[model samples]
Target: MDATVNACIGSDRLFDSPTTMNASVAIESEMKWISGMRPILSEEDFFTWMSLIIYVTLFVALIGIISNLLVIITCARIGFSETINISYLALGIADLMASATRFYGSIFLLFEITTTKVHFDPRTVSSVVAFLPSQGFEKTAAFITAFIALERCLCVQFPLHVKTIVTKRKTIFSNVIIYIFAFGPSNLIHMVYRFKWVYNATQNRTVLAIDQSETRLRYILARALYAYYGTILNFTALIVVWICTVYLVLGLKRKAVARKENFKTSFIKDNKQKDLQVIKTVFLLAVTYLVCSIPTAITLLVPQFVPEFGSTRALARISRVSYMISGLMMQVNSCTNFFIFLYMGSRFRKALITLFKRH
Candidate 1:
């Protein structure tokens, strides 16, 4: 998920760096522990790599948008007869939106780099178009992936009963709930923070600033939601997905060894192959999601147990870089699923092929 955004305790927004804001505002808004905190990387060194990171992010966003779009279209074409289909569709939408927002940020940064008329901080561009939306979508994807893993786990354990339990109507409702609970809260960003133009006298340029003029209650609510995305939502998803993935992996090994006997009980040979393929596809997705999620997960989770690892504590510097790395990995997560399905999902591949032939 979102670990940090140059500020945001990996995504919590508590540490958001609004450099152009008044010093009094900064003091009032920020945690006292980070009053003079510094990054591990020297300013010179970090700036040197910033452009390359932006370019890489741009590339990731492009690939993610196109790939997730392919998945979205394919799932729609294939129909949502299975909970897996609807789950994939929801995830693709989330990933696509995240990538799209990040792509806009990439372009915003590229413009900043090229234009001489104004000097814009990366954090400013990120706040305007990237971090909040990305955090929301990432949260959405995290829960969706967990749901898929759990759904698959049940299918593996109770093959005949899963469809009955996770019915189409129920799945549709669950997805609606996921969207509301996971993605809807992000709307608070708009209510809580407004953007304004500020001229930077030192740099001799105008810059974008995040103006905190909202009600205290609104700000507190958004802050809590942001914390939820960075911590509770991700933490729960990671644990659930990890447990389910482990169970599914072990089940796959056992099922592989007894494929003939297990499927023969009721499922046809073709259905057996399809079911196995779906499992493998979901396994790859869950594994990639977990891998990408770890940096943020560890960064966010550690502060809860050991206060020193917090955004304002000893690990703050490393936490910042860790969050940045996790951000890159998150983009990678958004884009890589297309390849996973292309290689492992026969039904997905067939649907894609059929779609192209129709075109």
Candidate 2:
């Protein structure tokens, strides 16, 4: 959802001196930034829509928090001796993190919206504190989803050897590395930009402003990293998921054809059915990830091609709507996985039932 905001914050023109900004006369508004400026909609209309969206996001985040917690608990109880369990467990954790952060950010925005007058800009504060971590969790989830897809593809491609090649220990190590890669850049950004109390002219009060405490070289590096995370990192993960998903689909189709052409014994038939069921679960997951990601990807990619299409540029207003759409989809994606697991993952379902019975 915030691939653009989270990834492009470092390179934003608004990163001038981190001095306190006048809420009304800030030199630059951030991408997907919350403001009273009218986009295609009039100011009142825009804010109404934004308010509705913020409320919806808050609802989704709450549901997601509960759902993902269940997924985590179920996965833990199910155990992770199997490599697939390890991936599922990691994915649950990542989605849980994403949902929690989204909830945190959404609550702040809701407060800002409802209050008649506010001293601090809750949306502005959330942009950094909640969005950055949310982005990291989203990115981490993307990588783990892609990893799940790729792992399944390998298993299908090399049935006998895959178990040995993709062991549980190896899966654990891979998830750890994915977490590091996804979160490292965002955390680095936290270090470079420190928040401080500064007088905001628009609010007529002191508020925490993001203060920069880095050298010129570090600033440039941060920009490059942000650009990479926003564009290249997401692009790579999306492409990988796409390719793996296609490969798995084709393999399944070919197997279907083979099954129709040849007769198998009951034992063989049962085993093949089990394999197909597993593939179906992964296929559903990959497709869900792919469909949900396209909107966010467009927001991230469009600015790269159209230099004028920035958070502070000519197309800023239109892009806010796009951001709203994309943000909602990503949140849906984060929360939606638990249901997927519940319906498709037999082991997970059993574990969840057992968990509920225990409680």
**Best TM-score goes to which candidate?**
2
lDDT of each: 0.69, 0.70
lDDT of 1: 0.69
Q: In candidate 1, how many Å is residue 231 off?
A: 0.8
lDDT of 1 by residue, 1-359 (tens): 11122232122244241111111222222344555666455534543454566688889989999999999999998898787899899999999998998787656655544443444544454554576667778778888888888888988888888878888888778878988898787676666566788765544677776664557776677558656776678788888889989999898887776678756655577788888888888889999999988766665656579765433433444444455566677889989988898999878899999999999
Write the residue-wise lDDT of candidate 2 on 184-209 in tens digits.
66666665666777775545688766
Would you give me the overall lDDT of model 2? 0.70
The true-versus-predicted C-alpha distance at residue 249 of model 2, in Å, is 0.7
Error of 1 at 189 (Å): 2.0
